[model samples]
Target chain A: MARHLQDTIYKYVTMCLSGVALALIFIIIGVLIDSSYPALVVYGSKFFTSITWNAELTGSICYTSGIAHMCGATFGVLVYLTGTLLSSGIALLIGAPAAVGLAIVLAEIAPRRLASPISFVMELMAGIPSVIYGFWGILVLVPYLKSTLEVGLSHSLSSVPIFSGAVFSAGLLASGLILALMITPIIASISRDAMRQTPEGLKEAGRALGLTDWEITYKVVLPYARTSIIGSIALGLGRALGETMAVALVCGGASNFLPKTFFYPINTMAAFIVFQLDAAFTDPSGMSISVLAEMALLLMAITMIVNVVARLLVRRGFVSRPENLIQV
Target chain B: MEPDREPTNSVQLQDSFSFEGPVRPRNYTRRKALNLFVKGLLIVAAVLVLYPVVDILYLFAYKGLQVISISRLIETTAGAASFNPHAAGGLANAILGTLFIVGLSSMIAVPLGVFGGVYLAEFSNDNRFSSIVRFFADVLAGVPSIILGYVGFLVLVLRFNLGYSALGAAIVLSVLMFPYTVRATELALKRVPNGIKEGALALGSSKTTIINRLSLKFALPGILTGILLSLSISVGETAPLLYTAGFSDYINWTACCHTQIGYLTYVVFTFYTIPTTNAIDLSYLATFLLILIVLVINIVARVGLRRLSRDLESRI
Candidate 1:
């Protein structure tokens, strides 16, 4: 009877401990919504549309629908939203192709001895802290871009408005490139695993049909791993979107306006929250912090959607076991 | 000479030869060229992808080695307001504080995560509750660290009135570390084959006894890997700890609440922007230390995983 009771108690205890995850998610969402209530009520739908983000620190206090705020303090996330999307989009454009190519090389072209070491190196890259990336970005990439890429682009593509601009040390271009570097290892490793899983019989048939090695890879291997490759890219995209410190350091911290060119300053949603939070604490009306909470809410919702999509696609592909899913 | 008499036979021969001659060589050559070009591109892509990692490491080593020394490891950070190069100090405070905070967080998260994983792998069988927990754990993993920081600041620092304490930072770090541990533990436990359990059951051993004696022992290395990975993550994290932990120049060992703590990541983030040569050098040193620590942890984890898998193979 004692043993029976012990077994039952152990099961219940483990179950309750596991529920911590569920409780955590609920608490996070709950706190965000509860904190952002004032902003949500006041800003309504205009939060997405407006471009102004004045905290109105010096202005007199006012009330909008029972939420008190400094007068003329209008918050809008359009600039941040644009920055997040555009920077991540640029990262995807540059990273996805390079990652696919790297995957192909690792899976099809390189020998096992060579591939394993290179994959290890890439995993190390993934494990490197974000702050280090940001540190490297600020000290190295920003200056390098300013001196070379920006100057070269402006000179060569003078006719194209987006490519032609006064060069800055940090901006959309720097952030995008940094994000690309950050996401490449993630996309490459996952895609390489997926491509490696392609059936040998299919490649053999292609070879028998007089297909070259590259032809076999492109025609047989890539198509077989298509879903997984897409999933990996989406996963990379999710990382790029939420990447904070690196983007924050090199993003130039633009506000109240949208980026005008590739080299123009920008701020992502994730970065903006970090940048604005200290300042948000200054507003006596308490609405500024609430607005920041709303931004967090938006960012969370966006990442959640992307992650869900990525998981579905990955699950539909070769990796059915949950254990096999790569850590992002 | 016989062309006029045999026109139909000649036409048939010409048609058969025509089908084989021109098309095969032209198509084969084009395909071969295309294949070579793509292969070259793939090689280039691989090189490009690898260049940055090497560059970052080289850069850190080049700069960090110049600044790092025994004193740097033993001394505390200088005040943020002090800009004088002469007043610059070492990273002992940050290092110790990181150890304290990450250690505290590990103490809180490891058992919970391990137990949670055990539940998922052993106790539950596709029940609604377990599935819900699993799904939400994935969701929690996906949440941005900055948001976690914001929530941490709001709930722990402000509401709970911990006031930028080590305990607050540890709690936040544990939250960040939790999902990874649970997933890793569950996966490790699941890899334990069921045949052993069945055999033990036939011998009339209780389920709890089998888990405690057999499965836990087998999964120990994997569980350790998970804990190490989480520790590395906690060490590298900056966004979540930014507000919750705040920053300090000296190591405050006794106070868990109402006291700030220094960490390596904060130094890397804040110090470089300062113009002083000493400050920038210290930043590089901090970064180098971070990279070294994370690399060591990852290498240990990888080695552990390999040994565990080999052991499992030999036993099973």
Candidate 2:
């Protein structure tokens, strides 16, 4: 009887502990919504549509819908929203193809001797901290882009509107490139695992049809792993969207303005929160912080949607090995 | 064979099957060329993907080595007001503070996470509650760290009135780490074979005894790997800690609440753009240290864990 009772107690205790993980998600969402309510009430639709984001820190206090803010303060996240989407979009565009190609090499072409070392390197890359990536962006990538890529693009593509702007050292282009480098390992590693999971029987069937090695991979393995590859890309996109410090350092900290060109300055929602919170703290009305919370809410929602989609797409009855579930 | 059906098209089937002079397919060369081109592209892609890793390591090592010294490892960071080129202090405070915060958070997160994982793997067995827990843990993992930081600032620092304390930072870090640990533990426990449990049960051992004496032991290395991976993550995190931990120049060992703590990543983030060369150098040094620590943790988790798991499997 005592032994049975002990089992019951242990099970209940573990279940309650598990509940903590579930509770955290709700608590985060609730806290964000509760804090951002003031900004939500005041800004309403303009929050999504307008381009203005002046905190008006020195201006007289006023109330909109009983929420206090500086007289001229307005919060519009269109610029930040655009920055986040465009930068991540750029990262996806560059990273996905390279990642797929690298995955193909790792899954199909590379000898076992070569593959392990490369994988270890990729793991190290994934483990490198975001701030270090940001630091590297500041010291190396930004300057290199400014001197070589931006100059070359502006000169060679002078007639193209997006490509032909006054080039800056840090902006959308650099942020996108940095994010690309950061997320490549993630996408490549996941896609490589998925591609490797393509059944041996399927490859044998392709070979029996006299397909070349490359043909076998492209026709059989890639098709087999299509959903998983897409899922991995979505995962990568989710990561790029939420990347903060690296984008913060290299995105040129644009505010109240949209990016005009590839080289134009921009700011992501995640980066904006980090950059703006200091100034937000100074706003006596406390609405500025609420606006930042709203931005965080938006970021959370976007990433969650992407993650949900990834989960759905990646969960198509494939028996995912535990080791393949590398932390994203 | 000759008359299975009427001849399908203009050309007779017999004539189509007649032996050709060489029997070369028209698109063979094209296919081969396409395959070769793609193979080349794949190789190039692999190289391009790998180049940045090398570049980052080389850059950090070349720059960080110049600034890194024994004194820098032992001294506390100097205040910005005392700005000087030659006399800037080290990151001893940040290092100790990082250890303290990560250690404290680990203490809070590990047992809860492990127990949570056990519930999912051993007890709940795909019930609605466990599924909800699993889904939310995944979603939590995907949530942005900066968003976590904002929430941490709002709830812990402001509402709880922890006031930018180490305890606040540790709580936030533990939250960031909780999902990883839970997932890892669940996966590890699930990997334990059911046959052993059945055998133990047939022998009249209780479920609790089997779990305590058998399964958890087998899954120990995996659980440790998870903890180590999360530890590495928390070590390098800057965003959440920026507000919750709040920076300090000196190490405060006694106060866990309402006192700011220093950390390495903050040094890299804030000091890099400072005008003084010393500040920049310190930043590089911090980056170097962070990279070193993170890499070592990752290697141990990935490589060492694999070997240990293999040894355990062999023994079993």
Proportion of true inter-chain contacts also present in candidate 2 = 0.74
lDDT of 1: 0.85
Clashes of each: 0, 0
lDDT of 1 at A169: 82
Question: DockQ of candidate 1?
Answer: 0.56
Over the stretch B1-316, how does candidate 1's per-residue lDDT look in tens digits?
3221235544766788544332232367778889899899899989998898889889998888988888778889865336775665889999999999999999899999999998998899858998888778877877888989999988998788888889999999999889888877887787778888889989988878988898887777777777887788789999988879988999788446889999999999988877877777889999999999988988888765667766875787
lDDT of prediction 2: 0.87
Backbone clash total for model 1 is: 0
Share of true Cα-Cα contacts across chains kept by each model: 0.67, 0.74
Cand. 1 TM to true fold: 0.94
Off by over 4 Å in 1: A316-326, B1-26, B79-84
Poorly placed runs, candidate 2 (over 4 Å): A316-323, B1-26, B79-83
Chain A fold similarity by TM-score, each prediction: 0.95, 0.96
